[model samples]
Target: MTTQQGTALTHALAEVPGPLPTSGVIHVATPHTSRFTIVGNHLAQHAELSLTAIGLGTHIQSLPTGSRIGIKSLAARFPEGETRIATALRELEAHGYLHRTRVRLANGRITTRTVFRNQPGPTGAPHPEPPTPTSAPAPAPAPAPAAAPAPAPAPTSAPVPAPAPTPGPAPTPPATRGSVPVPAPEPAPVPSASRPAPVPQTHPPAPAPSCPARKGPARLLPQPRELTAELRQTASMLLADLRRHAPELVLSEADIERLTPATATWLERDARPETIRQALTTDLPQPVKYPAKFVRHRLTVLLPPPLPGTEELPPDRPTLVIPMQNCEGCERGYRSRVPGHCRGCRAQLSAA
Candidate 1:
């Protein structure tokens, strides 16, 4: 080609448009210089072109080359909503970037009768135009009558007849007591062959016999008072018996000494009668000594009735006897003294 012809062709191709081909497609030179005509040429060559192919992802493709596609088609392509593609199309049309056309298809033939675009059009090309404004007209005035008439005064007249009083009272009926109604007999239930036979009733499995009344008194037996001399004597006797039976219980000398005073105080003040009872009744046979600290502080003493033929008490089982002594360290026990440690040696202990 000649230099001028080649330059013209290059310029024409440079401004080639409607929309560029997809990234992978080749852009062929075309004789058209108009961007719209270039785009139409590309569209004709490709048969179909997506707005996305031209880097117009947001632009709607519902507008056909020569006809307007329905909103449903737009919705199907962009199911997300009009806000995405439809908005983009509206914006592009508003900014003169795109155009739309409305056409009708009849008898298998398509006809484009209207075109919508921001650009001015040639004779037959439809162009987008601003809507015309219409103002409302003033209302018509009311008509005047030809003549005026004078008003007349009103006059009083005869009174209306009072409505006739309701006719004479209806005839009175004799008072009679209603008869007592008889209850209807319930109908016998019909038996069905398909239904299972009813099982014979046996004396409702004689309500499992009630447990025998407890042998001892029903009400909880009153625990023996700890303060009484009798209760202390009983506890001492029990402790001695336990010790004699089970020597392995490891009642250290110190433990015994400490318990002796605590036992005395516990017996004197009647402290924890329940604990005393449990100690006596526990199944284990072990030496029982009143915690020493408690005995020193509270000084409880219990003296039970003397056993027959026993005066000084036998050596095998010595009775617990608490003697009053001067106060040593404050009489708090392990749990009460060092809550977070073992009181015996002041060693740290875990919280319960």
Candidate 2:
């Protein structure tokens, strides 16, 4: 709106005839012609969403396609920290204003895909707009009330006397410099013996005790074996090369030297160098404060159990022994699994 028009409108409102309200809001709306988003009132006045979530939703809707809305990126752009921003994003996601999914690409790389909806309607339908109010046609003007009969003609010589004004309630007089104000009477005090005893306040009963949470079995470091030169060198190389996989895991020579023995323990248990590296590097925590300490903790806690040797395995149960039996056709002592003829007797029978 133009400045002159706004000023005129304000003056017009001020000149209104009736008494103005003592409280409540008055809106002076202006049309937007550029750089504006069409956010629906459903989102703007959502009952469940917090102010931060609604605002974040609107901001996301206003941004052009391909703009980064990741927590870190948004945290950098706005004053809100990553935790609050993450919470706002979660709220948006829970309320269907935002959707996020982890997608795996053809090249075996994983990435997050986010979608922001301006109006999250069920069944993918657009939210209906509020109907505009239509003004009713003004009623036909009512016939003017008939004028009262002209007052009885008064004598030309006598002037008609004016009617007396109706009286109203008298207004209170303001306090004067010489006036002495009346003081309110004080409440009478009761004797201590006559006063009732004060009742003691009671509190609600305490809640029942909850069971303690179960914890996972503790991880204890395995017994160490003699560290061979080959094992030590391999462990040191693995520890030093960790930075190649995760730059945050960079360690000094002394740190690597101190942690080599722990890593060597994994190697002594027949754990491969690749496995050891993967355990150390995969899923590294954000902002690794002390890389050396983190590596040591992982090396000790995630140590693989030593493989069992052949002699260490329990032996199988002994096989059952078969009983001997005499051959029926041999007429001589012979052994067989069943009562069958010996080879000589069978051959003689065949020849006959």
Candidate 3:
């Protein structure tokens, strides 16, 4: 910090009226040297000692006067160890390094109480008497300069001619005797007024045409498909369709079983007969029962991407499921119905 800033900090510290708070310890990590300087300087000046005394004061007595005490004893005396430098200084102020006042009321009458220290002495040393001052003798002056001879004066010359002045109006003097008076001019003649001609009002130009609004593709709800003996084969076809057309919506082998019932129902209700038949045959089916339009809508609404890839197969795949087995709030398999407990068994649990 600049000297001016440091001085300002010191002034602010002095205005605080006491040492730093006990809790305001300077940490080893990211040490605040500026704050340390402010606190250390203030304590040193107020306690009438050096910075060393400020450090020593923390461990030994509340206030350390000189170098008579040992560090070991100082450390033992203060509970906070070496880091108690700030706390100790504050304790000293609290214990009377500076003055404090208190007001007390008894029988509705106020009484003032004052506390301070006026004398200064060594912490553990014997008291000494005040010293007297002695006056010093005056010094002698140096000798004067030597004498010199005089000389004759020279003759003076005549003055030169003054130059001619340039011509212009002379400045007028102020009207001292009375205020200056002036004549007023006559008013302008009024002219004959004429009626304004009628003019047709023009309408503002129409605004330019805007770009056509974009309409999102229609979202067809999934058709409800019948559960039959060919469920496994049908699921394989749906998986193939997802891979071929919407590879981004990757689902694992286990995910296929989990999603098949709902997907089949969706397809049966919404898809064409040919789309359903195609989805049932090939490993990589095209134009399958689950259309890209509907699948994209479902994925956008229900799942966050990037979706799981084909590499993450079957049992190891990340399942988009809410744990229902541990639920214990209601008889039904549903967990969403419970507000603050498991819906299945009515057991107290966290809200979803």
Candidate 4:
């Protein structure tokens, strides 16, 4: 091949336009760069072959394997919702381009990691999987209940197999064997006083008795007070509402401890659960940094004042004195003491 000419395999496709026709609203299939063209073809081969999968796959494959790919980040970047983004990621996993492995760190913590490749077949990859922690061995089985000792056999004598013949010949009659002569006997004297008395027996003294050690009553520590059923239910309902409004924020136990009192404050102000939910969620920022604080502040500030009771209403009072009709002498309002005159007019007439 000459220096000016390029081989077919290594050569880049050179396209030259020739008197082309015009078209209205053109769609660009591939990006300007060659790497992107490869990526586009990679996505086309695998994936659910849907627009969403293609978009997500293209976005993911553009970055290195160990990149932080959060659901919210993808949702914001693409026009699709969070649910659609999550589904597309799963679809990518179904294809060979994506691999997600759950790794356990040495610190006894576990996390999921994703590995991405534009092409398939990681058959001889050298990365070793995280070690699986060994679980504690089960406790040695309760010593099998000791078998009861076998009962001792009762003592028994063997019976003779055969009867024995009568000893020698039959015994002679008593009369033949009997008969004898009499003899004289002499008397013996009592023992002398000098004979020593039988010696007395002696036994060793008994050893001192032993006393067992005494044990005192065991002392126990006090247990923490448990939350009542009603309070727990209320807290769960409030937290559920909070989670719905702020999905990104996770409340710890300490956060719950701080939020419980705020919930109580809202409850005391005659605020319904739905009202409290709306008040806290009304104009929430896209991402709330401190959910617990924001919720508590809203609950504390949105309280309406208490209404008055029936006892505070006004009582009955006496009517003021006024004339029903105006008098000819003076036109004034007064209680109708005189038929057609004010009190002053009546008094003046009486004086005249």
Candidate 5:
């Protein structure tokens, strides 16, 4: 090839869109025109989040509104299982990417509402600007001093002298009497003209009413009745011993703890330990993928009702009339309502 032609061909190759040359993973970019989710790098590349959490969050964001993302649902859809899915949800919540709140509806049903955020708030994400420091309010400007009244203008002329008292006042002075001296009245205070009037107190608007937190649904298994230390220990032992009956039925500590209460419920219902063992060990699936779930299912489905009390027994019962007695004549056992003789003695006497 000619040098100019080779150069032109190299330029064309460079212009063609292709995966960028890189040592590690390469990316072939494609624009998503119809359906796509835009995730911020802050969340996609979060330093604290694990790979499972990041992926789970991305999947949740892509789903449409009103989608079910519960632990069980997610577990069913993906192979991560319920436990890992639950942990990932918690991680997302801690990082402020998800929020779950239980709210009571007008119909009095309690349900959980979940909210997802693309960008976390101050609680989890870094704040761009430091909080403006709260400064003390500038002291209210001192009330302007009241202006002093202008000195009364000096009289244009000298004040007139008082007239002399009348000379004929001495008719008869009244006799002096003992009396208490009254205190002089104080002068009224002068109001300041520049001082502002007092402002009436205004109460802050009452906070919006909040709904009380209502309890969630009842547990899948019934609780043990009259729970006591002995009952709890017995249930725990029964669960721990199940592995001996069926080697494949081994349960973990968590499983044992969870099933203990249900087992205790069985004992409370008057079920014998042997009977419970038979119920659990008789039906053996070739492989028990989740031992705890299997055990829980059995416990719930096979739970017996409580035994009736003595008062509940029927009042009418069959009575036996014939009572066993020893014959006086021969000392032989006979059946009669009262003391009597054997048939042989009665026949011999009659013959005479």
Candidate 6:
């Protein structure tokens, strides 16, 4: 873990006893990052690298020509646990730095093909811990061996008879008893609709009913609708100020309608207009790719935490689950952690 110890370890690995791989580090550039950066990032958390794994990687990269690496061989060379060495190799493969293929030898036996990649390799490489083949080659047929001896027969015995039941005397019946008489059936009554109505005298006309009671607006949600024209203009001005921070972002009418409620939320929390503006604009990078996302994260962070008690709504109120994204293909929505794609579309892509 110390500097001197790491240098000594590196030197020791450099003089490893047999033939080594002849691979060297190569730089590759992509739109996002290089292959080395990707691998390093996977190994490096918060810009700090794991010492043992990174050392193993450096050693693997410096291996000489025709040198093959395997879990068992690396385990023998490394003083650490075999499982740990295997895991590091797996990490290497996951980051596309290493690939392994199954090679059949001339002697009718198979071995591994260890391919060291300085940059990202092509897709569809075999697994590092390749599975044991469920269907193996058929074995050659052999001649039958000597047969076993037969068993001897036993002597026959006479069968036994089962016992019969004993006879019993019969008893006389009791004095004669008469059966009860059945009742006659009754007919069903006629329906009231089929009967005639009685004659009635004419009555005076009733006065017209009073006007029906006025009902409130049929809004789906009781959203705030009483904001004055002045407040709306102020909301528009605040949004315009947010736009100055990231001019690349464009807002639609619907987006404005949706965002006005957010500004209102900040105001209700007693956030000052200048403070809100700073929250939306302060420290923003130039040429922002996703202004909506930038503003969303800042707004969420600036939100005041809920009160200690009574933060939760009453149980009687129904919980509303808002979908984060809707599938472009199926048009169904889901509250997924990942953006843009739903479960169905993901599965559909895999199948395709």
Q: Work out the TM-score per prediction.
A: 0.16, 0.38, 0.20, 0.29, 0.40, 0.27
Off by over 4 Å in 5: 1-27, 127-352
Tens-digit per-residue lDDT, 1-352, candidate 1: 6999999767766787676566765466545555332122222222233343222322323333544433445567655564455554443333333434323476766432322332211322233332211111111111111110000110111122132122121111011011011011111111121121211121132121222244664222123334466655554544444445444333445544434434544444445555554453445433445433322222222323323454566658677754433223444343332133234333323223
User: Model 5, 48-105: lDDT tens per residue?
Assistant: 8999999999999888878999888999999998878988988877766676665579
* Better TM-score candidate (3, 5): 5
Cα displacement (Å) at residue 195, model 3: 63
Clashing pairs for predicted structure model 2, backbone only: none
lDDT of 1 at 84: 55
Higher TM-score: candidate 3 or 6? 6
Clashes of each: 21, 0, 21, 4, 0, 5
Cα lDDT tens digits, model 4, 1-352, are 6655655322323232243337654332333755542353546644245678777777786765457776788777778888888777766655544555555789989765455555432331222331111111111111211110111110111123122123221122122122111001110111111121211110111111111135555323211144455655685568655766657546777776666655655555456787777776778877788776666556556655555566886776899876477667777765566567777887999999
**Model 2 Cα lDDT, one tens digit per residue, 101-122:** 5557999997765666664523
Cα lDDT listed for each candidate: 0.35, 0.65, 0.36, 0.50, 0.66, 0.50
Put the candidates in TM-score order, highest first: 5, 2, 4, 6, 3, 1
Tell how far residue 62 is off in model 1, in angstroms. Answer: 10
TM-score of candidate 1 to 2 decimals: 0.16
Model 3 TM-score?
0.20
Worst 10 contiguous positions by lDDT, candidate 5: 175-184
For model 4, the run of ten residues with the poorest summed lDDT: 181-190
RMSD of 4: 40.6
